[model samples]
Target: MACVAPSSRASPRRFRLTSTAMMESAPTTRAAITAARARSILRAVSGNLDVPGGEPLGYADPIGKILSFNKLEMNEALPPAQRAKQLGADEYPFFGYPGWERNDAANRRLPHDYMHPPWAGQTCVGHARAVLNAMRAGRPYPVKAAISVASNPLLSLADVRKTYEALSSLDLYVVAEYYLTPSAALADYVFPICTTVETTELWHGTDFCVACPSGIQPLYERRNTYDFWRGLAVRLGQKEHWPWENVEQVWDYCLAPVGLTFQKLVEQNGIFGRREYKRYEKLGFGTPSGKVEIRSSIFEALGCAPLPVYREMVLSPQGDPEIYRQYPLVLITGSRFMPMYHSEWRQIQAAREKRPDPLVTLHPETATKLGLKEGDWTRVSTPKGAIRMRLHISDMVDPRMADADHGWWFPERKEAELFDVFESNANILCPDDSELCSPEIGSWPHTALLCRVEKE
Candidate 1:
């Protein structure tokens, strides 16, 4: 493995993993793996020492194990009836242990699902579309306030129109963000938050951990997320719950029970404890059967399909052939890009230059049929809404398919109307209807949709 800083002005310093023979092809191969997939693979492989490659060596990660173990223990600790009352517990009993007691009397009292305040508890597993719908309809009860973290729902959520209405209806909306994002611009109060570069991070895996110190002091009035939350807790008269005065103190508490301190851990680089492979052989997996279940018992108990299966999407060409004739292209939204994160850093000259405009990548044939030249401004439309993007005619996508970017807003433009978020926003074209979501989490189809491209 070798780290090579790219010569290109747009590319950041990146690490290259290579075998002795494939050094030349390493960069291209690595680039093919999307950032999201790479992260997903890392998460899946973390501490999985049971792989066939070698014997797993190390102690069980006390710090990491305890973090998850605490959640499981507390979940099991919840009172049976109280746990069942949790929204979505009835439908998604695997959400908590008490959910196993489906016949509980208290579970019968509460509705199978809540249309209002849509599952607002420790088990924050509610559908975004459902919650937003409740807020707009004001049925059962009204939702009057919302606190947004580093999220820009207006530009990032499916059905931008509904999100806009729900946010606009809020009596109080607070956003903590690094920039005046399109969502933040509509906030009643927006607090400046420190960036990762200005904030320390405690990076931990299942068996290894590292403490990253902030490289530089926070610029201007920016503060870390902990400080922001702590300050709010104080104002809300819940200061007792937040005893830590600073981020370091919070870190100390986290490490103290593990027989380590932030200072000590930093000195030692990190806690790389012993490895115990095939842990299920002894302690058993954290499942109902105490082993891997090919068919999830939890899902079965909750009346959900025990096995994964594909279902036809409502907005897809296959599902609605009538719409397919109008919108000929298969639209896949939000493919990951290297330079910028979701709807962020577009204002930076360096990053913006790498992708100066929002782009719709399509097959060269599709672009020609649509009368689009390379880099030509074009309108992409679905039944829900439309957005404009520059065309990047490429053979990477199928002849009848296109991939559009997400989370776009012109930071340099007027902030009065959320930087004109609807202009090139991908979510505007997405549907958040109940029929369009999954039965489990109400996950809307963002990747696959029917869209038409027209030269602007």
Candidate 2:
């Protein structure tokens, strides 16, 4: 979902709708997508569609907008003998869209039928594509295994039920998590992953790099992701492949090229580099053309439009009139918020106190039309399904569209209805149908779909 305002680092200021005094709902009395508004709706997240800008909304747009720079340029120029074809490159060759590094492409390969169509560009084997294909006839991949880390597929992916189906059917589903999340509960094995405070990371920038060391030891058998991988490798008889016993040794090896160790870098307060420009003159552009290709050759070779143009989505109100009639208000999911970091910080008391419920932001006028108040809980339904969210009446959103928090689950209410996952998750209202997916990249619609809201 598109952010109505840019995220501020200064202070996490949020509009608590219940406390707000005045909410004018006049400018958007025409909020419902009935006649004129239907002709000009806020196009959703695929970079293909551009909207008329007012007060700048960001984040969601950037995901697809950057695809024009398709990462194939990073290694596109590699000789065929030195390079290997990436997964889904045959179907969705929007340049490194499969999210596989060039060298690692051969390691993962799906069955022929699964490799064919309904490609999800960046969603990695995609939310639905991977699941659907794995569940397809004749047992393509003999074993279905997923080692989930830093992701809650049940909440993150579209269609909660379908996600459950795929996860349950998996031969071995391993999850690295701190708690027994609804998604983790289904896992065949759950590894306790250490928190950021219990792990080390290099907070690096263009000019300088600094070591952010772990604050405390990993508690109660909790291990970092590195050790987890190493443990797997060791058990699988690939122990020699992982020479380093722990992350510290690995960090030392990484920093050795720069003539520094992690300890040295930390003691020195990190390494600094002089700001340099025009390096392209000395070396060369990292592309097949040796220059930025405004009209990418890779796109042409892969049967995509060479030059960029604002191509309308595969499904539009004009093309899909029947669905629009059923679910009219433009429902945008995956909206970013300050209170939580994409379903992670919900367990934090401070964050929960800041924003208590899953919110569906609607124009004040739109809310009035639908007999909804700022605090009223509403059942938001799309053609796919329905989920409940509180109405956040504000002029921030265009009257014709509604924006809802995407990932919503309550750790406190774990026993209550799948941790109250299905109750308010915006993905519940989103469909994984290939028709609703972006044609060029096959990204399922998280934002562009239509929905209707009602009092719960």
Supply the TM-score for candidate 2.
0.73
Model 1, 35-133: lDDT tens digits are: 223422332344323443432322345644322212212233456565444443343444333333332222223222110111223334445665576
Q: How big is the positional error of residue 203 in model 1, measured in Å on the Cα after superposition? A: 0.9
Give the poorly placed runs of model 1, Cα more than 4 Å off.
1-49, 54-123
CA-lDDT, candidates in order: 0.67, 0.61
lDDT of 2 by residue, 1-88 (tens): 0121211111223432311211211112232212112212222111112223321112121121111112212334455543333333
Estimate the TM-score of every prediction.
0.79, 0.73
Question: Cα RMSDs of all predictions?
Answer: 10.1, 11.8
lDDT for position 133 in model 2 = 53
Residues forming the 10-long window of minimal summed lDDT in candidate 1: 1-10
